[model samples]
Target: MAFFTGKVALVTGGSSGIGRATAVAFARQGAKVVVASRRVAEGEETIGLVKAAGSEGFFIKTDVTNEADIKTMVEKTITAYDRLDYACNSAGMEQQPTPITEQTEETFDQIVNINFKGIWLSMKHQISQMLQNGGGAIVNISSAAAIRPIPGIHLYNASKEAVLGLTKSVALDYAKSGIRVNAICPGGVKTEMFERFTKDNPQAADAIIQMHPMGRVGESEEIADGVVWLCSDQASFVTGQILAIDGGFILQ
Candidate 1:
């Protein structure tokens, strides 16, 4: 539990779901956490959970799609913690199943901006800070859809796949610099995103659950375990790798 006794962790989209769970997980291990999301109320709530877990943290109202906001997030994290040891870029969006013909440029822009461009800008500034600190670890939240497409959310799938490529490329760039970067492909974890998905396609709820050989969907905390592990010293040798916490969704 003291593995991160004096360390710091940053989690984007930390207002709820996987991001919220990850922040609390880091706190439980003794790391001070920085929770960032555009949602102020939920973000502050995450901070409360972090404090309850025996560590201190603050919430930052941030929109990852903006480069300025991304820069300020890291800056603010350092301002509070002095250095950043781990980071998880979990801020992303899900697009409801829509035919390509019906999808508009607006949808494409919003999805790509949040899922792809956001991570890019995030990593750009984050890596700069990590390099200055002499080393750090980063975990990006991709999706199993990157490997097994759901047939409708093509943009979401593509954005996640791009995360894989970017993860490897960044890992290589900072390989000798004491920094590591990796991606996690989660299946149908019980997150708000999943709820929204199932709510939109009522029939999809069951179909999605059965796709997992585990006979059920995963919890956001389960994925949080993977994120925290990737950022821990136990994974010191793991980098540029894709860790699947999907309950065998991609197996079929």
Candidate 2:
């Protein structure tokens, strides 16, 4: 039987990029998938990919910043699958580079609310369900910025670092209860966000590529593969850890 043959996974921000990739990966392993995102059309497209992988899939229009939407997202998942087996909190946002001196409170709130607060809220509901189900796994998509300082994006840096703190604490709290909570710190990835960030600076783009020891940007599927492994029984002993899949970005 497939490793995840009877499992169910919830992936927030599943409309595109890493979230979409992780949802598809779970489905490929025979798990029914719940894809939660604000973009209905793109989320439904992800479900199509999941169905193409031959596993059942559902979509929930969710805004993680809204507590009610998050609760509904979890409820709808259980309503469809009866249990929650795994979750990937991949909903995140990155603003254009701005100095801290010029940063606005509105921008700070936007970044923190979605990137940090969203994951916390997600875990609150996901853990409650996992406790009832006896056990499960969760992967939060943190960033390399959380590990090392990055200039021009102070808000994004702070928000991602905060996610790590919360991930470790929650993992420790629930480790004894059979829930594994972990975070993935990915380096520069070739996503729409990355593309948007580097569009105006060819030299900056080249600098990013060279920063990774791998000599290239990471792919969404690469991160998805790690997420799948972490959520699988193979990683049962792993919790309260931050896995850096950053291709040596922090090493340099």
Candidate 3:
């Protein structure tokens, strides 16, 4: 039987990058998936990819930072699938790089709102839904920045660190209730966000690859694979851990 046959999954930020790859992965494994993102067109593209992979899929317009949008996303998922078997809170934003001393309050707040509070709101509603069904798995897309700070982007690093803490708390609080939560810290993946960062600071881009002992940037599908494993029964005993898929960046 397919590992995720008859399951239902919701992936926030499913319009692109790691989120898009992960959403497609779940659907290919036989799970009905809900792809939510603020970009309606891109979100629909992801849904189409999921359908092409041979599973049911739909798109929901969502802004992870907004509580109302998150509530609607969860409600729609339940309304369509009856229960949520898995949820991957991967929606986030990366602002222009700024030194800690020069960072404005507006920039800091924007980063925190999307990266940290977004996950919090998603967990609140997703956990509630999973409880009704008796169990589920959740994987939060954090970054290696959570473990090792990037010099120019302090706010982004701090926000990811918060994600790690949140993942642990949710895992512990609901482990006995049959829910599992974990975080994946991907480093230097070749995504639109990474490309934008590189475009803004080419030197930083080169340095980033050199830092990865593997000598190449990681791919979105690679991170997606880690997420899929974490959500599958293969990782049944794992919870509250941050798995790094960073091409050996941290080791160096």
lDDT of 1 by residue, 101-180 (tens): 99999999999999999999999999999989999999999999998988988899999999999999999999999999
The weakest ten consecutive residues by lDDT in model 3 span 93-102
TM-score, candidate 3, is 0.98
lDDT of 1 at 17: 91
TM-scores for all candidates?
0.98, 0.98, 0.98
Question: lDDT of each model, Cα atoms only?
Answer: 0.94, 0.93, 0.93
Kindly give the number of clashing pairs for every candidate.
Answer: 0, 0, 0
* Tens-digit per-residue lDDT, 1-252, candidate 2: 576998999999999999999999999999999999999999999999999999988999999999999999999999988999999999999877787789999998899999999999999999999999999999999999899867888899889999999999999899899999999999998887888888889998998899899899899999999999999888889998899989899998
Instruction: Output the worst ten-in-a-row residue range by lDDT, candidate 1.
Output: 194-203
lDDT-superior candidate, 1 or 3: 1
For model 3, the stretches where C-alpha displacement exceeds 4 angstroms are none
